[model samples]
Target: MGTGNNRTITKTRRKIRDVDQIKADLLCARHLEQFKDSKRPEDLPGLGQNYCIECAKWFDTETTLKAHKRGKPHKRRVKQLREEPEPDPRRIPGAQTTSQSIGQCYDTQSAHVAHMEVDT
Candidate 1:
């Protein structure tokens, strides 16, 4: 029994494509590490020199970056990105190596459920 305008506004919201790309980067250990401390120039705002990998945002200056780091959102992200303590290797039943996983595919699927793997 309210104005339909509000409902339309909420339903029309669209997601940014970069969010998906950010997720992909966050999942890769090497990418996250490189982004965290790398001084490389990027296409992002401020060339990504002053950027927050967790929030996927850039700041204009180190002062602002420091301020953002103390903020609740950044603190939350820091906690979120903290790596989980690895289970002691000797505790596992049949674990092979102690080196941490790097998001590789689990295993090759059987032919019945997989497509032909051809070099093209």
Candidate 2:
């Protein structure tokens, strides 16, 4: 194989860029929305129309993508993603969150600052 061929490479498997792109995509509403029911581009592979969200992979066709979803690799990726903890959108800057999912708006910023004060 060539040293720099990208067509054969998967997104998460790429060496040059980290998986930060995937993380950023997760923050977007449209990213997760596609998982419910996917919509493809007419031009083909346009901005990764047939993308696998969990594995960060792109397929050229819907048939191939459906096949991938049935495969073990895609299932494993889905499992792995589910196991990872969901990041808090209300995360405080420079503060470690002490409260998680309190069923209401809880300020982690103040809690963290108070904790820091006690530590120092």
**Residue-level lDDT for 48 in candidate 1:** 68
What lDDT tens digits, residue by residue, belong to model 2 across residues 62-89? 8999999999987876676556567667
Q: For model 1, give the 10-residue run with minimal summed lDDT.
A: 111-120
Instruction: Give the poorly placed runs of model 2, Cα more than 4 Å off.
Output: 1-13, 16-24, 30-47, 85-95, 98-120
Listed in order, each prediction's TM-score against the native is 0.39, 0.42
Tell me, by TM-score, which candidate is best.
Answer: 2
lDDT by residue (2-108, candidate 1, tens digit) is 66587667665533224434554666665555545654566555666786766777787888988998899888765655645465656656544433244632232
Instruction: Return the top candidate by lDDT.
Output: 1
Candidate 2 residue 19 C-alpha distance from true site, Å: 6.3
